[model samples]
Target chain A: MNRRDFKIISEWIKKESTVLDLGCGDSTLLNYLVASKDINGYGLEKDIEKVQESIKKDISVIQADFNVGLEQYFENNFFDYAIMTQALQENKNPDRIILEMLRVAKEGIVTFPNMGFWKNRFQLGFLGRMPISKSLPNNWFDTPNIHLCTFEDFERLCRDLKIKIIEKKVLNNSYSTNFFLKLFPNLFGEIALYRFEKTN
Target chain B: MENKFDKKSVGIVVPKTAEIKHSLSLDCGKVLEKFSLVFETYGKLNKEKSNAILICHALSGDHHAAGYHSNDDKKPGWWDSCIGPGKPFDTNKFFIVSLNNLGGCMGSTGPNTTNIETGIEYGPDFPIVTVNDWVNSQKLLADFLEIEKWACVVGGSLGGMQALQWAISYPDKIKNSIIVAAAAKLSAQNIAFNEVARQAIITDPEFHDGHYNKFGVIPKRGLSIARMLGHITYLSDDSMRQKFGRDLREGKLHFGYDVDFQVESYLRYQAQAFVDRFDANTYLLMTKALDYFDPAKDHGGELFKAFKNTESKFLVISFTSDWRFSPAKSHEIVKALLKARKNVSYAEIEANQGHDAFLMPIPHYFNVLRNFMENL
Candidate 1:
């Protein structure tokens, strides 16, 4: 949604790490990471125009679908970090794809819009309709986010899957967290960014 | 978007012949004591003889890849769309060379050329030449031109296969390779189509086992049938539907096997025109080479291993509707290049022209080509 998530992801990534950016639309984050961290990596995108843009930026990108999985194309543990920015909910199976990412990389970083935010709750509970807040802008019928998840729901999934959450960042609409967000992130936080590793 | 390199700028260019007296060894272990090659060159080679780019021609394609052969000729070379001054190939920046393959019907030594020893047309007796053979012959031309290494070797379809072979055969001799709409090997279905075309040519009574040249007769019917079949594979269903569809040629169906459908009339015209210029034996050899191409076979059944020793960077392009050499086929090559850790860029353009889309002036396709050539 903003450069905040990209900056946080870049901070988590180490210099010279081999990274793979999933659904790297136009490769804005990947390009930033390359310039800041000097990382060697590739961006996997599905749109032809986005892939071409990445090429123009001198980023190595492969035009592919994230739903089909990356098992056949990339080697195991070849990447140091697999980053997905605001695209986890759009995945057909987030759990399976995250596991797939862990298989190819040692660590995985993902960001998603928090459906349990206060505004969304107020819209769905008081208005008696699907929320259409700043974070969830699309209408209920046309939204690309198939699996809307809250901060707690994501943490619960990590615990269930035994994935180690190395770090977590919760942000509001302006991409900065306040005391209210720290106290009740599931209610106040509009976006959640996580850095995790597979225990297995 | 000015079309600076238009038809009028096609300017005077002619094919030149080079006779190599050295005995060349083929991949099939055959030997040709001597041979001749027909080629055309545009742009000047620098003093260091370095800025050379070789354009390989596909099946039925000859040395005339760009520019007019004579002032009166109405049509330029087949790939004039992308080759010229300030174009993707950019004659201003590089020396462009295109040659008729060894087994082609063009001025090069092919089925129509006279055998050195027999003093008769080689016809069907011409030894089978593989992609490797073509690359070897091109090297002779490179040597004669004083180019120690080509800046790039580019081709589409069968020509693309030769480009791949060039990188594999002499990794140090080619700096870059542009392979479009080509595969490492043909599929079973692909081989089946070629087999049908070959059958059409050989079964004709006039063929007489490819000695029609000596009998002062041409297997026009058989060649026409083969060309007609090849034309179908070169185009996609959507392309054919858009171009001809079920429209009647005379506004009413004859219903008697006469050219009723407009598509039938189009195919008939294409076949007849092809028969007038091409030889049947060359068609047979071209298909045979396509079937025999399998660079991965000798490399432990792994396409990646085939590129392990390749030193040249590659730019691979494929079209969406090119069922003859689908995007999946192009992916096979791209994936192998990646596995081998070679520098590669791939693009699958949206197109409805099928295999022939590589020859068309698709804006995005040309943009990628131009960018790649400029960067190289």
Candidate 2:
């Protein structure tokens, strides 16, 4: 009930709107949204144990691999927002999934680690190995981040996909950077959060 | 695994009641009819009794709900898991009574019984009995026993239909009702299955229009085939695969259709064994009764209206793999019950066992039943 992510998600969501949380592990965020914000939320998680936990908490979750596409569930403009926190880079086709999220929802919210942060760039340039930082925690072989990208790379891809960014924030650990993110986001930010609307 | 007992004893020894009588009479207007009630009670009935449970039997079921007879090799009747001394419907606290239905062949006045007028077996000439008739006879038995109302009435399959009828007909007679693997009305497919079985019986050469007894013959093959078909409906395909796949009877295939497959041989044995105890005419009559069952039809075609007056708590159970009376049918029942604003709990158990899952000792069924009964 008092988790930091739950608090952040609760504050971010508006009252009484349709929400779909992708990779919503155990549905704690959705449950919080349902109880506190009065938002109708459904979760999609791949792990069986997490799905069971979600069910035990009386949360509606469909256990499926979201990378295969959610065509069965959502038609165009089905949800007010599709939230993917700490899960965009883990997908097999991150860019395609992002487009699908935008296609399904009026707006898409994505959060991921900033791979072009100074520490990661320093580790890759000086050490000549994969960056193992606080945000990206896995070693080379067992890591789930296959197509990790920087904040600037996501902005370029968003431009190419004709998606307009409504708002963007960068987080250093749990604190949001107000000034530094707007100035030099690719270097100073450790995590990038963006809200975008599909234009194409 | 067979137990030795006296075949001619007429009654099995029960634990309670100083001298237990076998038959109880109910005057159905013109004739004085008797009900064949075989019950084994484990506890005492208190004054102003509030702890009585009446167990109802399904199709092809009898009154032996728990324990073994000294001579009978067959196991106790179905629902033994929930009716034992310390089980959910614990006999230690409640007085349990199970009766053989009026048209049942198992020591009941069915087609096998003799009619007083002709001094011959009733056979096919017995009057068509409805679920109401069965419940009426149970009412007589309850009156004879001096029991005012039952704490609960629990049953499965056809037994479930009777339980629903009891709740609708005599709303105040029961406090709780548990209906498992049942429907408010028999579907067209179910009716078709029964029709096929009836045709199988009457078409047999030896049937002779239910007068085969005169010729010292019985419709064994026809009845066996009917039973084989009915048995297939009672089980799921997954259960069949787990039981007997394509394994041969002996070493190799017979190359002809003489029971080469193990499942074929097993079904044949089941059919033949069933013919020994069950009467063919009774089978036809019971199947017809089940076919004609329409609780909703009686109330101007509104099922929820039929249950509008019921104040009893309900527990409706359906198995996931039972295609005969599937979970969808149970959901229909639930929808009607919900419309009536009655307190109802439902569980569609995940099991490979088909409609007969209510009779099996699956833990999921046991847990749900136990929880419901204990809460009541």
Candidate 3:
């Protein structure tokens, strides 16, 4: 099945443009971009096996830790776009990464699991336990989602980083957005997709 | 004869020598007037002649890359595991070309061969060849074979440099280039190792200033030392520890450097085997070529600029424990390829086999190669 998120991300990319996919696990999205958008895509993945898998797909992928910045490898505005999907919270420095992405590419696309989703709020408000739901599946003690945030929190951070959000889409856990979910994105949306560019 | 080798093997192959009618000018400002290239081919070339791959050899590699020469042969070719019916490079699907480069000591022309004018061994007279010269010679070979475009050009270490040069020099001649455990140029430290190896050979009294063949005396001690040093660089500390682990060969210390350690014994055996077959002059020439390889030198010193004209896709692989030509070097190539907007794939395999990992049949390494070839 085509990942709805990948379909959406592929749609936003310009044809035949250069791209860098951050934390490109298995490089399925980059692969999709090459096939769909005819883009020259590169990926930076931490896991070696995933890097190998990406090679098998005939995709150019560098095995490198995302926590370690990428400025040294890429020059300013080297790529047409930089894209990261569902990997904002479990990072040592998400803000630094966003700025680095902007430094390397003309534009960027980011996605993360939304913390203000109604189900997450129910776990925190009603049961009085740490938020746990479909998107945030791990127990609070062992969860990798360390810096989970709501919609407003992300917007404020983006504003602080001088990254202007060009477009924003909020989707449910099934990767779909509905009329009601769009009406109350912060409380109802489980996933967040944002396209941004440098203010300058 | 009954089939005695493994089913997947190409089996009972023979090498053929092709006289290069075209004179090739060397990068060292000399012309190769006459030379022969010894080559071996496996698998059938399709009618379209599209499914053909070229395998370039490293410093000591020859055209004998796969299969057995005789029914009684003990071991198969160097890359037998990778050049068979169902292996990576898969002979069942693609025709594979392996050649002894122009300035090689194998059946091809090199220091071991007689000069056309002097009627004696070329020895030190074998003009110092470079990676560029090798690629140009390979182009002639491709022309001789009538292969319009190679499906892929593959190599490891110095061989990998040749692959990169192949892509850069004759971009339209290859569809893909697989470079494993190599860099665009030798680092200062890498050049130092080669210098040391060169010094060892020249210091031998029997070396006779690179004409040991004149006196029928091989520089056994000197060449052995050089080969031993190369052996050390090709393996990692982890692999060495796992293999020898300070294990005493004689179960006790000999105290007099009489091969007490198992690692020492292993190195000696390899050195002796190498010294017997390898020509010291050819070794010297090969080291010089490796030291001189810098594809970016002419392109405004920008590696990416060198690859700007390349149309072939690239797959650059490196081993984790290969300190000799580490993953960092491969990354440099990948970065340049990215800057050039070329289709490139980089895979740094988690291997303890060091630079020698490319020759090994590591399941993961082989899997990536197999998949890349299959997809192509």
lDDT (Cα, tens digit) per residue for candidate 3, span A62-176? 7777655276467789899999888889877788888988889999899999888888888889988888777888998999877888998999998888889998888898998
Q: Estimate, for each residue in B84-161, the C-alpha lDDT of model 3 and write its tens digit.
A: 999998998999999998879888999899888788889888899999999999999998999999999999999999
What global local distance difference test value does model 2 have? 0.76
List pairs with backbone clashes in candidate 2.
Answer: B5-B70, B5-B71
Candidate 3 or 1, higher lDDT: 3
Residue-wise C-alpha lDDT for candidate 1, range B1-376, written one tens digit per residue? 2333354344667789989777899878889998999999987888877889999999889998888766567878999889888789988888999999998888889889999898988999998899889999999988877789999999999999999999999999999998999999999999999999999889999999999987888888888888888899999999999998899989997779789899999999999989989989999999999999999999888999999999998888899999999988988998888778776767788999999999999988888788778766
DockQ of 3: 0.60
- Kindly report the TM-score of the first chain in candidate 2: 0.91
Candidate 1 fraction of reference contacts recovered: 0.09
DockQ of each: 0.35, 0.05, 0.60
Misplaced by over 4 Å in model 1 are A1-4, A69-72, A126-129, A172-188, B1-10, B44-50
Candidate 1 chain A TM-score vs. reference chain A: 0.96
Ranking by DockQ: 3, 1, 2
Residue B64, model 2: lDDT of 71
